[model samples]
Target: MAARGEVSTGVSADSEPEPGWLPDAAIVLSGGRGSRLGGTPKGRVRVGDIPLLDGVLDAVSAAGIQRAVVVGHPPSLERAGVVVTREDPPFAGPLAGVAAGLLALPDLPGKAWVMVLACDLPRAGEVIPLLLTGSPAEDDGAGVARERVQGADGWLVVDDAGRRQWLAGCYRIGPLRAACAAASTEGPDGLVGLPLRAAFGRLHLREVPDPHGASADVDTPEDLMRARAAARRSHRERMES
Candidate 1:
C-alpha cells in the first residue's frame, strides 16, 4: 500500500492484478455523528473485536483498491495507502463526507470507478464483491455481465427490505464528480446537509440485490449487538468448516 494521499501502482508485485471491472479507487464515508449509538464514532466502534473502520478498510484493500480516502477521524490514523480526512465543519452529512473523500482522492481517468462505502457496515467484506460483480442468483440470466450495462452511472445495493443503500454503491468517477458539483451549487452551505439521493438522483444507477442483508449498517445499540452476534456466528461457522 502507498502512503496517505499518494498514488500507487495499485497491484503489488506478489499479488494478482484486479479485474478490469473493479473500481480504481474508493471513498469511505465515516464522518457520521452516530447519534443513535450515544455519540460514539461509528468507525471506532468494535464489531466483534475489530474496529468498524479497520474492517471496512481491510475489505477495500482485499478488493485491490490501492487509492482510498477515509472521510472521518478514525482511531487508526496511519493506514497504508488510505488517506484520512474530515469533512468541512465535520459531521455535516454523508453527502459532505462523500465530497470530502472525493476531493481527497487523487485524480483518475474518466472511465475510472470509485466505490463509496460507509464505515459502520460489518458485512462490507461480503458486500463489496457483490457491488463489483452482480449476484448470479439475483441476475436475470445476464449474470455478472449485467454489471457492465452501457451508460449506467453505477450500481447501488438494494437491501433485502428494498431500500437503496446509497453509501454502499460503486460509481463512475465522472458522473459522481458531476453529481457533487451540482450538489455543491444547490446550497450556500455547499454539500453540507444535502441528501445523497438529491445529489445522485440524476445518474442512471442499476439496483443490485443484497441477498444476504450485506448492506445492513450499524446505527443503534441493537444494530451493533446484531452485527456482533452475526460476526460470532460467522467465526464459528468458519472454524467448523
Candidate 2:
C-alpha cells in the first residue's frame, strides 16, 4: 500500500487526497472452533476474568472501532450489538471470515475503517491502531501491516512455537479485497504454505515489522497463563509510568 506510516489519499503519496470523516467500522473474527482447545470457542473462553472476545472488543473500541461486525456462530458469540456473520463458501478458515468482511464493503455501518481482528490475542490495544499506520487516509481503502518478525519466515511474526496465526492480522479495504478476490479464483486450499508465500511475493507492497506488544496470542493453557502474567506486568509498568 502507501509507504509504511507514510499516508496520503490515492495509491501514491502525491495522489493521496483528503479522506472523508469515516465514523469507525471493524470485523471481529470469531468464527474459529478452537479445535486445538478441544473444540472450545476460543473467543468465548475467559481470560483475565473476562471472556476472551470481551478483551478483544475492548481493544477495538479503545482504538475507535465504533461500528463492528463479528463472524461466528451465535452460541459462540454472545457479545451483544456485534453484527455477527460466518465463513463464506469454501469455508477456508479465517480467510473466508475476512472475505465476508470485505464483501460487506461500503455497506458497513458508519462506513468507517473496516479492521479485522481475532479474539485470541494477548492484548489488542497497541496493535489495533498500528494496523492503520500504513493507511493513506481514514477512508481511502488503504493500509496493511506486516505482522513483524526477525527472519525470512519473518511472516511468522507472532507465532507461538508453531501455530501461524493469520486472522489476527489487519489490512485496509483496498488491497485486502484484491487479495481476497485473487485467492477466491484459485480456491481456498491454495492460499497457504508455498502458494501463500508466492502470492505475497508478487505484490507491490510495503512490509512493516511494527507490530505492538499486544500482538501476541495464546493457544494452550500454558500460553494463556503466560499471557495473563504478561498483561499483569504491562499494567504494573503502565501504572508506574
Clashes within 3 Å, all models in order: 0, 3
Give candidate 1's whole-model lDDT: 0.79
lDDT (tens digit, per residue) of candidate 2 on 103-160: 6555532212345677787576665654544331223435332222111111212332
lDDT of 1 at 96: 86
Q: Please give the RMSD of candidate 1 to the true structure.
A: 5.3
The parts of candidate 2 lying over 4 Å away from their true place are 1-24, 74-81, 89-91, 106-113, 132-170, 188-204, 210-213, 234-241
Highest-scoring model, TM-score: 1
Lowest-lDDT window of 10 residues in candidate 2?
147-156
- Tens digits of lDDT, candidate 1, 25-84: 889988877788988899989997999999999998887677788998888578778888
Top model number, lDDT: 1
* Superposed model 1: Cα runs more than 4 Å off: 1-20, 135-143, 146-148
lDDT of each: 0.79, 0.52
